[model samples]
Target chain A: MRWEGRAWVFGDNVDTDQIIPGRYLRRVSYDELGRYAMTGADPEFPEKVREGDILVAGRNFGCGSSREQAVMALQQAGIACVVAESFARIFYRNALNRGLPTVEAREDPTEIVEDGERVVVDLDELVLRSESGEVPLREPPEFARRAWREGGLLELARRNPERPPWR
Target chain B: MATVVERFLSEKCGERVEAGDVAVVEPDVIMLHDGSGATALRTLRELGTERVKRPDRVVLIFDHSVPPSSVEAANRQNELLAFARRHGIERVHVDEGVCHQILVERGYARPGRVIFGGDSHTPTAGGVAALGFGFGGTDMAFTLLYGELWLRVPRTIRVHVTGDLGPGVTAKDLALTIVGELGAGYADYAVLEYTGLPERLPVGDRMCLCNLATEAGAKSAYVPPAEGPERLRPGDADETVELDASEVEPVVSVPDAVDRVRPVGDVQGEEITRVFVGSCTNGRYRDIRAFTEALDALGGPDPNVRIVVVPASRRVLLRLARDGTLERLIELGASVAPPGCGPCLGEHLGVLGDDDVCVSTANRNFPGRMGSVEADIYLASPLTAAVAAARGELADPREELPRTALERVSGS
Candidate 1:
């Protein structure tokens, strides 16, 4: 799978609260949640975001809260993919579980990718291309890649129904 | 040698596993709270799963939005209740306590067991030597349908705690100091195995230590079994951090960053508008009692400040009531909220307003955590929080409370 979009850059430790505050958690619908995505970090984020935008961030992209809404909010906001220097464990898992592509760039993408610059993410080749240069991305595990291909674990679960793939 | 987590996961999987290996295992307990349950139920419906595989293993607690802070929250909770009824899941708790506290208090989290909850603070079960951690709603839904989940076994980091805590210094201070030293995300995808804690340390303090491990990006945290052969060897961990409890001063995490810690003296005299002492982090009975005792010694909170105290659970509240701690706190001008996560996540009951400065004992202090983004939150121990309440500003607990009072509160 591949994605091509404009880059939206953020600094380190962008916690789940910053992605979507706890107050907005009462709203369960993903579409409604999209309106508040990244509003905690920047109030104008929802309005500034366009469909098929790629987020470029520094280390520890999703630091706090195990709320899957953080991942859902970004996906619902039309973020095609997230490329970060690193990611918190739960958020990384949630992203894949929700069929959202997350790439851990070998180098800090925030240092190379400018805000609003066009970027391309090639999951098959594990490489991220921006105007500055190409940044290599760590290869995700086979299971994770499969989950992304299957459009999340829900579809995988539906296919099996009787047992999980691991079992 | 296998680390404690490796051993625990091995037991669950009925096969030997190590760090970096993926294992499919069944958890002894699956916890869901109001915050994550509705989403999981929705995903379960989407999956077209009609029945939960192991309804008996599921535990549902309503604590995050207890009493339903708004119409939307109420509607979501109602949906959860209806789903629970339809599934025939029997272990359901409402407005009882935070899910983490209730899990341990009810004995669902035990030594050598594997537990999974929908909240990050689920590592609070590590206090009992259980291997517990958080999962997302979609993953939780899949687990509910299949009765098992796959996990990558995590490497272990040993936090070697030693020495005795000084007067007025509590576990919360030590937790902050550790997080400050290690930085957030230091333990990402790893298990923090806390060793060398004094056996006499109360279970509540142990819980506090494990609760904040989430801030450091730990997948889980564990304390060695009190009386068992499943001990962690010296070199079992990938890394080790030495921390002397006596050297830990009363510290606070400044606004917007859980790891941005400073000594209380460094930020002393900063005026505060609110003081909160509660949540899964420090809402245990001992914390409330310690706060009340310190506040009593200081002659009650300042008139200009609003002090809100929340118990971690109904049982903790009942204990305080039986010991007169609850009455004394009310007499001292504290408004006691129900036994749940009050204002910790900024949903209801003491949400801070713009420009509000609060000293809270909850876990996270990120922007808009307890209210307005402009509000500044200082995360500290109950003792320091009590002092801030009394002075209406950040103050050193050791300077305010008598040594005897401090010792008594610290259980030193």
Candidate 2:
């Protein structure tokens, strides 16, 4: 799978609370949640973000809280993929479980990719291309790759009704 | 040569496994609280599973929005209760306490058991030698449906501590120091196994250390097996770090970043509007008793500050009441809330107003955590929070606590 979009850059330790605050957690619907995505970090983010944009961030992206709503909010806001220097483990797992592609760039994407610059993410080749340069990405594990290919764990589970994929 | 977590997971899975290996295993207990239970139930329905595979292993607790902070919250909790009733899941707690505290108090998180909860602080179970961690809603739903989940066996980081904490310094201070040194992401995808802890350290203090490992990005934290059939010692780990407790000083996590810690003297005299002494991090009975004893020695809280105290569990509250600590706190101008999470998540009960500054004993000081985004929060020990309440500003507890009072509070 591949994605091409404009880049939205964030700094290190952009925690789950910054992605979506607890006040908006009462509403589970993605559309309602999308309107407030990243508002904690920048109030104008929701209004300025366009559909199919890619997020470039520094180390430890999604660092706080285990709320999956953070992932859902980003997806609802039309973010095509997230490329970071590193990711908090739970958020990385949640994003993959929900079929949202995440790449851990070999170099810090925030240092190379400028906001609003055009970028391309090629999961098959594990590379990210931006105007400045091309950055290598770590390949996800086989199970995670399969989850992304199947459009998430839910879809994969549906395809195999008798038992879960891991089982 | 297996670490504590590896041994626990291997036993549960009935196979030998090590770091980086993926295995499907069943947990002895599955915990869901108000914050995540509703979402998990909805996902279960969407997955077309009506009956949970092991209702007997599930424990549901409503502590996030106890007494229903809003109509929407009320409806959601009601839905969870109804679902629990239908599934015949008998272990349900409402308005009892924080889910992690209740899990330990009820003995559900036994030594060497694998436990799963819906909140990130589920690692608190490791205080008792259990391997516990958080799962997302959909993952939890899937586990409920199939009674098992796959996990990558995490590498372990062993933290060895020696010596004793100095006067007026508590476990919270030590936790903050470790987190500050490790940085927020140093332990990502790893388990922290604490060894060489003071032999007489209280369970509450152990829980405090384990609880804050999440801030360092650890999947879970563990100490050596305290009791049970298994008597295990610290074994092979990916890395090791050492901490000398005697050299530690009272510290605080400055506003908005938990890993941004500094000595109490650096931020002393910063005026605060409120003081909160509760949460899963430091709401145990001993924490409250320390606060109460310090406050009594200081005469009382300042008239200009608002102080709120909440116990970690119903049992804690009952103990405080029976021991007369609750009455003394109320007499000293504290507004005690129920035995649940109060304003820690900014949900209800003591949410801060715009521009408010608070000294809190709870973990996490992210923006908007306890209230308005404009508000500032400093994470400190209960003793430090009590001193801040007395002075209406940050002050070193060491200077304020008389030596006799300090000795009594520290149980020296």
Candidate 3:
């Protein structure tokens, strides 16, 4: 998938509280969640966001709460993809399992791309390009990439349980 | 090395274990929340499982969406009743309390064992020395199908706390502080073993430590069986064939602090928009007393803050009520919620508004963690929370606790 979007920059350890906030969990509907995405960290986030916007963040993105709602909120917000330095394990798996494209931004994408700067994400090449330069977003470790390509290991196993290649 | 808990689950349950693999344990108890119980019951019927291998191992708790907030929820409760009766898995905790609070107060989770539930914070069982984690509904259904489940043995990270917390820091503060430094997913598939703080903390605080293990991106967190002059429990070995404790120092790839940190900034924020004083983390009688004492010291909390006190169990609630603690809190503006999840899951009552900011003693302050997708939740100790509730913002409680209160909290 090839896509381009402007980046929404966030700093280190951006926790789940900032992403979805715990209070709206009871709402349950995806639309309600989308409206409040990142309200804690940036109150105007929902209104300011546009479709195909990429979330650019530092380490531990999506850290806290395994609730799938956090992912749904971002997806519903029309987040094209999330590129972070690293991710919480469960959140990373949940993101990929739900079919949201996520990549680790290698070499500070911060210097090359700014908030609202026109940028392109090339999933095939795992590269990001802007006015400054082309930067490679770290590809998921082999196993995770395989899992991502195969629609998550659990789904893969369910579809072809007998030929479990990982086994 | 595999922990004894891991070795036990691995040897007993034939699953190739990895630290992060979520396991479905045949819950010695199955607690359901509101309409969720109905979902569990319906799934059970569809699976057509005959005779639960251990009927005694299940518990149905109806704490979420309780008092039947809606007709649909009430209908779900009836279905739960029918299922409980059909399966003979009695010990159903109804609208009386929250599931995690009730389980601990009622002794369903004892030291040194394992427990699983449909909710993720099942790690709250760590308060009583049990391995707890959340499971998928299908996984829970499968547990009913077969009494066993699979797991990945996780490597353990030992976090040693030395010296005493500088002041105002609670177990919640320590846990949050650690998670803050560790960057959430730093130790993705590890068991965080908190050690070397026996002289500085009580069993309650230790429980709080382990209960929030999930927040740090670890599968679970633990404390080596407490040893000391108070002798809360008896003699324990530092080593076992399954795992050895004494040999390890408190270590994590992420650093917690050069030392304990104070609040984020000098200003104590503003009047708390909300106050949450219960969870598997610190919802026990001890936590209750700590909170009340801090509240009393502040001459009760500010009028603006909405304090919600949820007991982990009916027993804890009963104890609080009998001791007049519940009455005191209520008089001071604390709303005593039923014995189950209140603000923890943002499920039932006590949800935060987008404009609200909370000071809570529960684990994790992740976005959308409390209930509102827009509210901000801050993690602090029970004392800190109590003081914050009274002071109308975050303030270290160590300065306010009477020497006697401090002594009792320290379990000295």
Q: Model 2: per-residue lDDT, tens digit, A13-131?
A: 89888899877776445347889899878889999898999999989999887888888899989998899999998888778778888889888878778888999999888899999
Give the per-residue lDDT digits (tens) of candidate 3, residues B60-145: 77776666655556676787787778878888878666666666667886656567666556666665566665553434544554
Indicate the docking level reached by candidate 1.
Answer: medium
- Over the stretch B295-397, how does candidate 2's per-residue lDDT look in tens digits? 8889899888999999999999999999999999999999999999888888778998887999999988888887688889999998899889989889899
True contacts kept of each: 0.69, 0.44, 0.31
Off by over 4 Å in 2: A27-31, B226-231
How would you encode candidate 1's per-residue C-alpha lDDT over B19-38 as one tens digit per residue?
A: 99998879999899998888
Superposed Cα RMSD, model 1: 1.6
Which residue pairs clash within candidate 1?
Answer: none
Candidate 2 residue pairs in clash (backbone atoms < 3 Å): none
Q: Find the number of clashing residue pairs for candidate 2.
A: 0
Q: What value does the TM-score of chain B take for model 3?
A: 0.80
Q: After superposition, how far is residue B245 of candidate 2 from its true place, in Å?
A: 0.1
> By TM-score, highest first, what's the ranking?
1, 2, 3
Cand. 2 Cα-lDDT: 0.86
> In terms of DockQ, which candidate is strongest?
1
A-chain TM-score per prediction? 0.93, 0.93, 0.82
